[model samples]
Target: MGASERVVPEGARRRRRPTKGGTVLSEQLIVETTLRLIGEHGAAALTVRRLGAALGCDPSAVYRYFKDTDELLLAVADELIGRTLNSWRPTGDWRADLRALGLRMHADYMAHPQAAMLACARVTGRRHEIRSVDAILGVLRGAGFPDAEAVRIYHVFVDQTLSFAALDASTLALPVRARELEARAWRETYARMPAETHPHIAATSGVLVAEMDRSGYPAALEMVLAAAAGRLAHVRSGPPGA
Candidate 1:
């Protein structure tokens, strides 16, 4: 059959895109290319025209695989989440498993700060995201929490991870000079605050100066996990079916 009339096998549909200018394309290729563009040149380089140029095809070819830039971006975000969870094999220890997941999420996103700045808050509804939700819920339920409690804890765990990842990634995305200035603010400004005018900050200024530049994600993740553990215990101790 002629190329235009040829039917892509059902299983191949997800991986294949229509060709243009002798350049073969696929959904995965576009997503990977967009990631490279964002990583190398920052998020500002993510336009369809730029993507098409990188792919050696006309700009419209990108739309053949993704409905629009927003849709394509959601795919990109999902790809990041997928990579973090792809090889992750959860041990039976729920808390430790969750801690590992949270750290991986933060580290991966922070590594791709430009992309994370755009994608961290998105609800991709893609395969990887759905799988992540199911995995977390499984961990909670396996630990003996009821469905309702499991869902709530899942929200807290996932949202806290993503929120902190986004926040930290934003800081990482800053120019080196800007980040350096921010790192110095606590030491040079807050640490110097007058005790009479800013009693609380003045008192904690030493600790703040030492710790303020660090990402708070690890501490925040631990707090969420600890709170979830407490909630699980409370549920276990409640009256039967109460």
Candidate 2:
């Protein structure tokens, strides 16, 4: 063959093999890349085009894994929930286990603040998430809660934990520039409020601003556990008059 038309080896004529790192993407890779993008750019900037650009592929590549952005967000949520499950374990002390789960979840979301906000309410019914819900329910039931009560407590506990984490992440994901503006506006608003017109607000202003940095998730979770335990105790104690 001519120099430009070199003879091909028996195996060399085959189409180039896809590299393991090629643009042929998997759902996990898409979710991971999307999460990384969300972490750096926040949810609003995580369009199909942007994600595809980051992944070094065509925008249509994402569609091969997820039908739309909502599907992609659901996948991201499932991935976060799976991460939480991997880090959580029941330590025999139901209340303590619940508290640990809450704290760990908060920490994980804070680690990926923008992604956490984006995936907050998108539930995928993924196996790991279902397993987590079941595990929490089992703990409540083992703590002497009836099936209905266990389900109720589980719903409240999971919802409260996720909701607080999302809210915390949303605040943390705010740009420093936006935060400064918000801080200035808050100070101005607080300063203009008449003490006589809003006695409780005026009285609590200092405490509110001072304690804002303190983590409230632990306290809030403890209160929830206390309420659940109290309700369980009352149910088992027979009537007060008895």
Per-residue error at 109 for model 1, in Å? 0.4
Which stretches of candidate 1 lie above 4 Å from their native place?
Answer: 1-23
Q: Write the per-residue lDDT of candidate 2 for residues 1-242, one digit (tens) a residue.
A: 11233333434433243323464456777789988988888788778888878777767655645667876788788889889889787888988888888888888888998888766666778776788888888888888787888899998898888888888887888888987776665566764567889887688777765556555787889999999989888768967433
Model 1 has an lDDT value of 0.85
Using TM-score, give the best candidate's number: 1
Worst 10 residues of 2 by lDDT: 1-10
Best by lDDT: 1
lDDT of 2: 0.77
Model 2: pairs clashing at backbone N, Cα or C within 3 Å: none
Model 2 segments more than 4 A misplaced: 1-24, 183-205, 239-242
TM-score per prediction, in order, is: 0.89, 0.80
